[model samples]
Target: MAKPPARLAASPASVTPPLGAKPVPFLAAVGLGLALRFLVPIPAGITVQAWTLLSIFVSTIAGLVLEPLPVGAWAFLSVSTAIATKTLTFPAAFCAFTNDVIWLIVVSFFFARGFEKTGLGQRVATLFVKLFGKSTLGLAYGLSVAEALIAPAMPSTTARAGGIFMPIINSLSLSAGSKPNDPSRKKLGAFLVQSQLQGSVNSSAMFLTAAAQNLLCMKLAAEMGASIVPALCGLLLTPLLMYKLFPPEIKDTPEAPKLADERLVAMGPMSRDERIMLGTMAAAVCLWVAGDMLGISAVTTAMLGLCVLLGSGVLQWRECLAYPAAWDTLFWFAVLVGMSGQLNNLGVITHFASQVGNQLVAANLGWPAVFGLLNVAYYALHYMFASQTAHVGALYSAFLAMMLATGVPPVIAALSLGFMSNLFGSITHFGSGQAAVYYGAGYLTLKEVFSYGALMSVVNLTLWGVVGGAWWKVLGLF
Candidate 1:
């Protein structure tokens, strides 16, 4: 009954407890908003309300980055400021509470809860290990397959990687004599850790529901008359790419499948809850895939699945309320979406885009060349960010708007940036929630994280840019 690592002790969906606020960062955040509101002259084309809202939005993003308060607190503050300042009316400020994309993400969190509660997620990972755990590389692929299979229902990448897979990965590495901080660390732990971390990033990019920001990206893309669907090209290539870039010390892991088999046997057959959970997940996926044809929205499909789980006793209503991550996500996501949508409506985004686009236009580059440059710039900028949701909230709309203004095709501009929102999470130890989980395990050194992260970033950009671009063309998305 030893305690788990501090990072792993809390519920997977629980918010990190706030350290007492830093007075300097807190003042800096407020100062930034005030400076933008008063000191900076409003551009001629932007309305006063738009200027006011922009100031609040910028401050909120700064608060997120600086951590003057918890993310949910910052979001709540932003909504209150907007309403109090008369920048947005009550309904206008809270309209995104009913947003379908926001609900879809919230519901998906419950889906993840069912997976964790019923132990179905663990069962799936072990089954894959039993099938493909004969070698280190094979084990990485097996875990990647499991990651992709469950990603759509799991919005929190941290929950998927940290809750289900990390424990099992720790067991496998230990049994193979690959303890962290020991000479044998590189034998299996280092390679598997990095491989699965990158694999999670790839899976996140492949599905709109895999990470919360993805649904935000989708809603933003839809504003520009472009749509994003599940992507398979990158998910199919991640394992092989990671194997080449970060080769494991132990080429063969003979004990992995045996370990997996033993664990599976110990768990016995899938219980009633697991079986019902599995069926609900399957029906949800099918409905989501054909949702447009069936005239059902993705959110509607997710709600239906949640209802089924509730009715079948797989998940109780009290448990859903106790799930802090879902409610926290709902609050922050709705506020950000509300403000972002209002910015679009007020032409703040368009005005900002035209200002930026004019400079790029002056370079006299073709739209293709502009796209390449902006794409790289956007992906590389993740080093400055610690949260994907913050980056998207602060920059995604503006960048997408600039691309459109510069005459990039709608689908290419919108969806390319949308996917890159998740892909860039591969770049840093602090890049996303799951990145922190893997890095916190004390397995990989700082040098290893940076070096492999950079390499994987390059590979992802190339694969998605060339291969994904070609695939989209064939599908007539462009």
Candidate 2:
């Protein structure tokens, strides 16, 4: 029998309340926000604030469409428009294509492909499931922990957690008697879904090397003349935060005494792929940490890793090209970078930044309060963005400028904003790529995703308030 199309699948906003359920009113609210930006006019010059708001609108429009092209593509288009309009120059338009951060993303794909092709990823996943596979929730923790452990070595959070872990979780949940279409299984499936997404985001955030944007944040910080040491600072606190913020569920407890035997047997043994991946990954990590010591750029180190994998016949040239997301990601990032250059060149960003900065100064705020305020505002802005790289590229400079104008030290302002950029993804499914991946896993409805994400945003903001203050004090940044 031909199947009837699912109502949710057929409609826009399938995972949430139907568009008509709250359509015009919701859109009106968004329109109001956009209108508010124009209420207090700023002088015309390259302004970060103007670009920030425009980026927000673009991101919102893109997320709603869910087109085959990712958010990054739209980002490119926006930048191109800025250039065509004389908002940016030719050199700035193309600079992102050559960015070190962009190269890091490219080379990481080669390494990831080599690892994935080996089928070793499945063995590792299976072994993890065997250890924690007895209960539904145990599987969640196992997958989450495994991703966290591997994130430092694997630059692609989507590849490590979303690509690798998500499939295993889906199959295991099905194997454990959670039927995919069973209405009763919805809640359980949703929980499993959240577990994987949360794990990916949390683990990715823990390591600077975990996501491309995280590395970009480090580079951007360095460009601003701050020494926050990406390798040293943020990761130490990741595991602790993951444990505290990630909740343990009661339903995931095993009904029978769990055994490690069958899963162990089913996994067979590791192959050449496993050993190769492990070696390559280990070598990559060493290079990442020791790159500065070895007098090499991180991009060079990433290229070397790619070369090792390709030259060794571990991953074929065509195979590397076939990995869709890597190139796709690059295109999007390049576009965003171009758009940023345009915003700066056109003088739109500067004008907007001045206006916002003046407003904050007039309010007579201190540094810490300004930090908290900007942090909240940025994350709140994420509700409209589906791409973190695009959002960060488009807005970081303007917001950073605003913070500095408010008497915050440049170093403190830069690093805190960089950290908050990654932290903001927890606000909505459309806030970041990883968040979207979680929603697509078919477990979480839009409402559930938003609820948890919003809650986590509050948690993160509170943590930022306390931890950021101490870190500032420790470093004498204030």
Candidate 3:
């Protein structure tokens, strides 16, 4: 396993990884999965389902083991195997590129790049620091609030949090006295980093527009004939109600980092790039929100945004062309969505759902009991997820099928899974993209990360399980 970085300064000087490390764990997982599927006696029609689940599990385990491979690389390997094995055809695998949600993410990436290049994101962060950096708790609250407010408008969490706020978090840690090997300083840094991760993960679940995965959930639910709006309110309100669950001390020792605040502020007045990109993004969002009424797909709105971005020179062709995340995202997402289509095509999802549904019904569990049990199962299932997309792609279908078989409304099931995806990511340091970003920063030790993640798990599970469930029932979703 690669050693975790000792502090933020230890990050590779460049964004790319050094040469000679093994490809990411996703590759190994795919290889092993393919080998197992080929050599094992699993049913022919069910082979894809087995391999998909195992690949996800192996990649996640590899992440926790501290493997040096990039997360996206692992995702690629898994998708490749599914294609090579003929479990999913190339056209089907490549279809995720055309997914409305994927296009939305791609367009958002361009906007985030503009934010970074034009200094708009920095100015926003600095403005927040000025407003809330007076105390430690205030800084924590500021970071969390900043992410929550921005999340609704940003489709890609990595682009929004990683691209925009990651540097800010790094600078904030330095300001908080997070020096290399200083236990006290490191502890502070860990708390702040985890705070930001949790805040982003939790708050992003609130709105349909908050995260791409949430949209995937809604889209999937729509395909299944369930409503998603009811679930949205639960995710939004539960996080606010659970704010007190985090350790109380993040608020105690407040002190703003003067240097970071000034640097962020000094970047000053929006540039041409910022205005054009921001305006384009805002316009795209307004169109997306009104898409249902206008009878246009959200993907069409995103493509419209992409066209303006490319045609207007807000971002050069080179800059727009340079983003590999879109391709990487499409590669894996395509495979999984394809695999899902296959499973549904083969009636495998329906079968699995029927089996699980029968078990629940036989046990005579009521709706609340069923909800609790399924969520617990969903939470445990995160031990197998390194990527949120991988989790949603691999598990949501099966869970939804079972929920439908059990007579649970599709909206309730979809919303529960949506909230669970974010909550489960809070269970470990490498549980989601944002968590990995913080973990890679190196201010937090493995033990510290685990401790904080586990602490937040209690709060998240309780809030979502108890309050979220009640909210669902009160809203007549149950």
- What TM-score goes with each of the models? 0.64, 0.60, 0.62
> What do the candidate models score in CA lDDT, each in turn?
0.73, 0.57, 0.59
Model 3 RMSD in angstroms: 8.7
Q: Mind giving the per-residue lDDT tens digits that candidate 1 earns over 187-235? A: 5787878888876876887766778788787864443212222245556
TM value for model 1: 0.64
Q: What is candidate 3's local distance difference test score?
A: 0.59
Candidate 1 pairs with clashing backbones: none
Q: Indicate the residue-level lDDT of 35 in model 3.
A: 62
Q: Which is the better candidate, 1 or 3, if ranked by lDDT?
A: 1
For residue 114, what is the lDDT in candidate 1? 81
Error of 1 at 71 (Å): 1.4
In terms of lDDT, the poorest run of 10 residues in model 2 is 224-233
The candidate 1 region of ten consecutive residues with least summed lDDT is 222-231
Candidate achieving higher TM-score, 1 or 2 = 1
Q: How well does candidate 3 score on lDDT at residue 331?
A: 49
Error of 1 at 321 (Å): 1.0
